[model samples]
Structure formats: C-alpha cells, structure tokens
Target: MRLRVCGICIQNERILLINHSLYGKDTFFWSPPGGGVQFGETATEALEREFLEETGLRVKVGKLLFINEHIEAPLHAVEMFFQIDSFEGTLKTGEDPELSAEGQVIEQVQFLSWDELTQFAPNQLHRIFSMIGSLDGVFHLQNYIPGQNSGLEK
Candidate 1:
C-alpha cells in the first residue's frame, strides 16, 4: 500500500484543488494537492514537497485532519490530510516530476468555492469536500474506510 500525504488550504472561503482525470476523459477526481511520501521523508516534509510540486506554493503543514483508506483493487493507498498552517508565493499550476510532460494528468489547479464544488457530481469529489463549509477550528481526526458508500456514486 502506498502512503500519501495531502495538504488542505482554505482561503477566502475557497479550497485548493487539483483536477485529475485518471481514467480516460470520462472519469475525473478532484482532491487536495499531495502525493506519495518519499523514502526517509517525514509526512510533513513530504506534504511540503508535494504542495510545492503540485501547486507551486511553499506551505507550512499543520495538524492532521483526516486519515483515509482508499482501496480499489490494484490501488490501495493510505492518505493523510493535514491543514496548511500558512503559505507563500502566488498560486500557479505545478507539475509532477514523476510524469513526463505528455503523461501528466493534472489539468488544472485552483481555489474552488464550496458552491462551485457542489455543482460537481458527488463521485467526482473527495468525500470530505461536502463538509468543507461546516469545518471550523480544530477538526477532530477522522477516518474514512474503503467501500463505504458516499451516496454520491454515479
């Protein structure tokens, strides 16, 4: 199983998201900016690196917010999402070093408001995205198990 780290950054009521289409043009998934942790790197360090690589932003990683288990056949990932304490630099689309220019699937990176997110089909977004507006200070650590229906499946 791959261990992944994701950073959550909310500003002006908009949340940062990376648009990815992993399964041809029909399947799109929107999630926070983050990636697999490299060897000998702490989760926080990996998150910082990923944010820089995917969003072109230098961010300070904060407390852990949620732990997610994603198991869908050959792809099993344990993902940790943390709140970004602070950030610097202007927002721009960043590239993943692991993929070639033509192989990259990241289409866009931008801050999306809660209302905008609701327009997407439920299955297209991260499970936690629905609760984004209600999230206040200090969210308790939560767990999302695989196979649980989000009721947004298309």
Candidate 2:
C-alpha cells in the first residue's frame, strides 16, 4: 500500500476537486487534490505540492481531518486527509505528471458546492466525500475505516 496525503480546500461554500479518468481503463474518479508522499518529504509538503500540481493552488496544510484505508482491487492506499488552512491562485485544470501526455487522468478541475457533489454516485467520488451528510461534517472526521466512508456503515 502507498501513503497519500489529500488536502480539503473549501472556499466560498465550494470545494476543490479533480475529475480523473483512469488511464487505459473506463473509469472516472472525483477526488480532492492529493497524491503519493514522496520519500523524504513530509505529509504536509507532499500535500502542498500535490495541491499546486492538481488544482493550481498553493495551500497551507492544517489539522489532520482523518485517515482512510482505501481498498479497491489493484489499489490500496492509506490516505491522510488534512484541512487546507488557506490558499491563493486562480483555479484551473492541472496535469498528473505520473501519467503520459496521452494517458493523463485529470479531465477537469472544479470548485463544487455540497449539493453539486450529491449528484455523483458514491462510487464516483472519493470515499471520504461519499459519506458526508454536510460539508461541515468533513471537519469532524477523524479516523475512517473501509465501510464507514462509503455510507455502508458507520
């Protein structure tokens, strides 16, 4: 499993997210700005870099919101979700350097309101978001398990 750090950035009642299509596969994922933590880099450092690369925003990482053990065949990540205390930059679609130009997964970058998120199926979104009743509940998350964030169980 890999360790990943994701930033929860909220501004003006909307949240930053990326529309990512898996390379060489017919799948799409809507998730926050985040990625694998590189060796020697702190989790906050990784989150900061990831936010800039994925959302075109420079962010200051805040408190740890929750920890999630994401489990899907072929991918299992121990993800750390942290609050983005602040940010500054024009929002824009960004690229994932890990993928080839032709296989880039990032399809769009957007700031979406809570209601906007409900339109997508739980499986289409990151598990952390798939379960929340309100955006404010995101800040209350602490430790997350497999089914807890998927609305299958608490």
Candidate 3:
C-alpha cells in the first residue's frame, strides 16, 4: 500500500494546481501539488519536496486539513490534505526538476483566482474550497469495516 500526502498551497486568494497530461486526457483536473510519502520521509517533508518541484516554492505546512479515502482511486490511495500557511520564493512552473512527479511538469503554474478555479473538472472541488471553513468536519472515512465490503461499487 502506498501512502501519499498533498497540501493546498493557497496564497493571495489563489490556489496552486498542476495541469496533468497523463492517461491521454487533454483537459486538466485541479489538484494540490503533492505526492507519495517516501520510505523515510515525513508528511511535511514530502509536501515540501512536491511543492518545490512542481510549483517552485518553499512552503510551510501548517495543519492537517483532510484525510481522504478513495475506494475508486488506485491501490492504497490514502491522501492527507494539509493547510500550508507560509512560503518563500517566486511561484513558477517546474523550477525544480527534482520535484516533478510522473506526468506533472509545470506548464501554467500561477495562482488561480477563485473564479478561475471553477473552470476545471470534478466540480466537487469547488465545494471543497467553500467548505474550507468547516475543515474539521469535512473528512469522511470510508469502507473501513474489517469484514464487510466497502460498498463503493463504482
């Protein structure tokens, strides 16, 4: 099972996202710049690496925001979302090659205004953004029953 942690690097009313070009998809789905936790790295470390690689910024991860369990995602896809409060550096695309993930190279790496964020796929993220105030109540644990199936028969 693989464990990954990502952070929503929000600044100046805009959020950081990557435009992925994998699986033959032409359009982009918005996601925070984050990736899998390595064998020995902590969640904060992984986030710092991913952010630097993808967005070219040094981030200060603040608090754990959400933990998502996706039955439909690939194997062992547990994601932790965090609140990043502070950072240093100019935001750009693919400034750190070492931090790039598979199929994730910075193309349009700038802060997207709130209105701009709506022009992406998976509309639920919009609600996710609105619900940021209730961050503590947003995390849902799915299909954790020991014997029973998760019932995520999608």
Candidate 4:
C-alpha cells in the first residue's frame, strides 16, 4: 500500500476544488487541491508545491483533517488530508495538462459553498463534507463508490 497526502482549503464557508476527467470520463468530482507526498518531502512541502502547480496559489499548511484508506482496485493508498490556510494570487484555471497523474489540469478552480455543492453530482466525496458538518477531527473513508443522490444536509 502506498501513502498519499492532500490539503483541503476552506474559506468563507466554501472549499476550493478542481474539476477532473478521470479515465476519459468527465466527472466533476470534488477534491482538495493537493497531491501525493514525495519520497523525502513532508506533507506540508508537497502540499505547497501541489497547490502552486495546480491552482497557481501559495498556501499555508494547517492542521491535519482526515485520513482515508482507499482500496480502489490495485491501488491501495492511505491518504492524509490536511487543512490549509493563507494563500497568495488570484485563483485561475488549467495549471497543467488535463487528466495527468502528475496533476490534473485545473479545469475549474472555484470555491463552492457547502450548500451549493449539493447541486453537483452526488456521492462526490461526501465523507469530507460530512466531516465538515460533524466536525469529526479525522475520518477513515473506505469502499467509496460514487452514485447519484443529493448529498446535502437535511
């Protein structure tokens, strides 16, 4: 199993997300602007690089948020999700080529409020969303299968 790390940047009740095309299918999934941790680089360092490379913004790494163990076929990865605060530069789009592991092109880089995010595809990583509401310090997400439903708060 490999280890990965990402950062969740939340500001003004909205979170920063990137639109990605996975496996040739255009899925507007929600994910924090972060990437895998390098061999020797710390999570903060990797996040800093990833944020800049993906969103063209500099971020100040904050507290650790969630830890997800994803078993998506041959790829079994343990992900460390963190909270990031402070950044520079106006958010833009398309940091790199679309749909690359190195990092997907920032097709859309906008802040979506929790309420507004419900309008998007359901099962779009709602564990993190729930965590936000419940204030669950850390989470362990497993067997995540995306589906259709309004993942909004009642």
Candidate 5:
C-alpha cells in the first residue's frame, strides 16, 4: 500500500482543495492538497512538499487530523490528513511529479467555501470534509478495514 499525506487549510471560511481528475476530466474529485510521502521523508515534510508542488504555497503542517485508507484494486493508499498551522506564498495550481506531462490529474487549485462544496455530490468530495464545521470533529483517525463499508464511498 502507498502512504500519502494531505493538508487541510481552512481560511476565510473556505477550504483549500485540488480538482483531482486522475480517472478522467469527467470524474473530477475534489480533495485536500496532498500527495504521496516520498522515500526517506517524514509525513510532515511530504505534506509541505506536496503543498508547494500542488498549491504553490509554503505551509507549516500541524496535528494529524485523520488517517484514511482508500482501496480500489491496484489503487490502494493510506492517506494521512493534517491541519495546516500557517502558510506564506501565492496560491496557484501546481503539478504532480508522479504524473506524466499529459497525465497530470490536478486541474484546478483554489479555496472553496462550504456553500460551494455543498454544490457537488457527496462522493465528489473527500469524506472527511463533512466534518469541517468543527475542528474537534475532524481531529480523529478513521481506519478502513478491507470490505467493511464505512458509509464513505471514497
């Protein structure tokens, strides 16, 4: 299984998200800004690097907010989501090194308000995003055992 790190940055009542379209342009998945943890790197370091790579921002990673497992045949991943304490830099869409020039999955990167998020289907967004209303509510680890339905499609 691959290990990934995600950063949660809520500013001005908006959440930072990247439009992930790995499957295709029609299947845009809105998710937190993050990517795989590289070899010999800590989760925090990976997250900082991912933010810079995907959002063009230098961020200070905070406490772990959630631990989620995504299993879909050959695409299994263990993702760790953390709170972003602070950041400095202009925000812009960035690229994923893992993808080829023509295979980049990130289409857009921006801060989306809760009202804007609700406009999409639940499955289109990360499940943990549902708890954004309360930081305390999002500060828990969510483990996924294979085959056990957790009510979260993603």
Candidate 6:
C-alpha cells in the first residue's frame, strides 16, 4: 500500500488539478497534486514537495480535510488530503520524477470550476470531487468519507 499526501488548493471557486494519462493516450485521471510519502518525510513535507514537483507551486499544507483509502489490486493508496494554507509562484504542468521521460503521463494542469468539472464523467475526477454539489460543498468533505465505496479509487 502507498501512503500518498494530496493538497487541496481552492481559490475563487476553482480547484487546482493535474490531468494524467497514466493508463494510455485515451485514458486520464484528474486528481490533486500529490504522490507517495518517502521514508523519514512528514505528510506536510511530502505535500509541499509534491505540489512543487507537479504544479510548479510552493505551498503550505494546512489542516487535514479527508482521509481516503483506495484498496484496488495495483493501486492501493491511503491518501491524506490537506487544505493549502497558502501558495506562490507560477502554475505550470510538471513531470513526475517517479516515471521515465518516455513514460510521462501528466497532460495538463489548471484550475477548474464547478461548471467545468460537471462536463466530465465523475470517474475522471478525484474521488473527493466526484459528488461535490457545488464549489462550496468542498468545505463539507469531512475528515471521513461516510459510505464505504462512495469514495474509493475508481
């Protein structure tokens, strides 16, 4: 299992997300910027490093918002989602150091609004975003996801 720390950076009702075609040219997964937490590194440290590495933005990890468990065969991950206290620097698409140049998967990086998010099928978004009623509904995502399968990896 992987312990991944993801950051939630919301501003003006838009959320920052990374578009990754990890499966293939036609398949994609849009999720917050984050990755595995290396040994000896704190979750906050991991989030900061991940945001910079994947979004070109330096961010301060804030309060914990959600703890999600994804236990699929090859993709089990216990993800910790934290609010971004602050951020700086230009936002740009970045590379995943864990993958090789020829295996790059990240395709786009941008802030998406609720309307923009609704255009895609729920499976395309991060699990937390799959059922958000509105941009403000994000604030109600408790530390725990109530239903068992409502928010697992897709």
Query: Which portions of model 2 miss their true places by more than 4 Å?
Result: 23-27, 147-154
Q: Which ten residues in a row have the lowest lDDT in candidate 6?
A: 145-154
What is the Cα-based lDDT of residue 78 in candidate 2?
90
lDDT of all predictions, in order shown? 0.82, 0.84, 0.63, 0.65, 0.82, 0.86
Measured against the true structure, the TM-scores of the candidates, in listed sequence, are 0.86, 0.89, 0.70, 0.73, 0.85, 0.91
For model 5, the local distance difference test gives 0.82
Which candidate model has the greater TM-score, 2 or 6? 6
Candidate ranking under lDDT, highest first, comes to 6, 2, 5, 1, 4, 3
Minimum summed lDDT over a 10-residue window in model 2 is located at: 145-154
Candidate 2 vs candidate 3: the TM-score winner is 2
lDDT of 1 by residue, 59-108 (tens): 99998887877766556688888999899998888888999998887878
Instruction: Name the runs in model 4 displaced over 4 angstroms.
Output: 96-105, 130-154
lDDT of 6 by residue, 56-150 (tens): 99998899988888765556778888999899999999999988999989999999998998898877887787757887777678775643443
Q: How big is the positional error of residue 138 in model 2, measured in Å on the Cα after superposition?
A: 0.8
- What is candidate 5's lDDT per residue for 51-148, written digit by digit as tens? 99999999999988667777666567888888999999999999988779998889999898877887888788877766455434454545542332
lDDT for each residue of candidate 2 in 1-154, tens digit (9 for 90 to 100): 7999988888889988888886335777789889999999999999999988888888889999888897665566899999999999988888888878897888889988999999988878887775678788788887775533333232
* Candidate 3 per-residue lDDT over residues 1-154, each given as its tens digit: 5677777766666777766543344554456677788888999999999888777889999878667644443344667778888989987776435445554444556666667764554542423444343323234322231222255444
On a 0 to 100 scale, what is the lDDT of residue 141 in model 1? 43
How many clashes show up in model 1?
0
Q: After superposition, how far is residue 66 of candidate 4 from its true place, in Å?
A: 2.5
Superposition-based RMSD of candidate 2 using all C-alpha atoms, in angstroms: 3.8
Worst 10 residues of 1 by lDDT: 145-154
lDDT of 4: 0.65
For candidate 1, what is the TM-score? 0.86
Tell me the lDDT of model 6 at 53.
90
* Cα RMSD, each candidate: 4.1, 3.8, 5.3, 7.2, 3.7, 3.0
